[model samples]
Target: MCIYNNADPNSGIQSGGVYWAYGPHNLSNQFGNHFVMNNQYDGAWVELCTGYNGTGKGESIISAGYGFVEDLSPINSIALGTGNNYPCSPP
Candidate 1:
């Protein structure tokens, strides 16, 4: 996944890429709206969570090849992959 620092998709600059792996990658003080792109191949997906290590509330699912601009202030961590145990609903 490519995470952009800016919310505007047209001009958003990519902050970094998150590869597919078993994760709970924590965001360090990220705030405001940001652009997130899920570029994984196959049916891989990502989950944004409100707490660290894939815990907490307000989870969101992003499927492969999809993107969105959203307020990430409440999101503290991200998990990569697809499974039945994920807290968020399928996208």
Candidate 2:
């Protein structure tokens, strides 16, 4: 799974770019920004980002690369908003 936080000054991440992210257990809700990406076995990715990162639904998920299960918290699996420059260029 990938997450691109355009305005994330802490991670120094840029927009229009894809990144693989893991559990954000300690992610802060200041301004309510953060993301949790899940790489399913179907070669597809599931991304969840929300205002508190669903602290209540915090659970563990098994990573693809490593069989180890990492702590994961499910958030607003809904797409609250979309980027303006969507319909991205063909990869």
Candidate 3:
């Protein structure tokens, strides 16, 4: 999910470039505040950027599993990689 500001992909704010992300977790520091997911991908990684039109410092791999970012930290520009590779069975 590529997050964009002003509802324009050309003006991206951040990205959730991963398979799936759940829960209330912070991505990392160096990212802008939450706005809207301008784009979403099903079978690919979401590329994150610090600015619009793919600008700013980029982090390709944010996580690899059901990952979570540091607590109380600034949200990162993007989160990458697949998720739920290993699902937990019923308790």
lDDT for residue 37 in candidate 3, whole number 0-100: 41
lDDT of 1 by residue, 1-91 (tens): 8788677767655555445566668777778888888888677777888888777774578888998886789888887875556754433
lDDT digits (tens) for residues 1-91 of candidate 2: 3333422335533253233443332233222343433334434323233324323332323233322222223343212112222121111
Residue 39 shift from truth in candidate 1, angstroms: 0.5
lDDT value, residue 13 of candidate 2: 33
lDDT (Cα, 0-100) at 85 in candidate 2: 20
Model 3 C-alpha lDDT per residue in residues 1-91, reported as the tens digit of each score: 4333433445544444322453222344433333334133454334344433333444333332212232212224343334542121111
Ranking the candidates on lDDT from highest down gives 1, 3, 2
Query: Candidate 1: what lDDT?
Result: 0.74
Model number with the top lDDT: 1
For the record, the alpha-carbon RMSD of candidate 3 to the native fold, in angstroms, is 11.6
Q: On lDDT, who's better, 1 or 2?
A: 1
After superposition, which runs of candidate 2 have C-alpha atoms over 4 Å from their true positions?
7-24, 29-40, 43-91
For model 3, name the residue pairs that clash: 17-46, 28-74, 28-76
Top-TM-score candidate index? 1
Rank candidates, TM-score, best first. 1, 3, 2
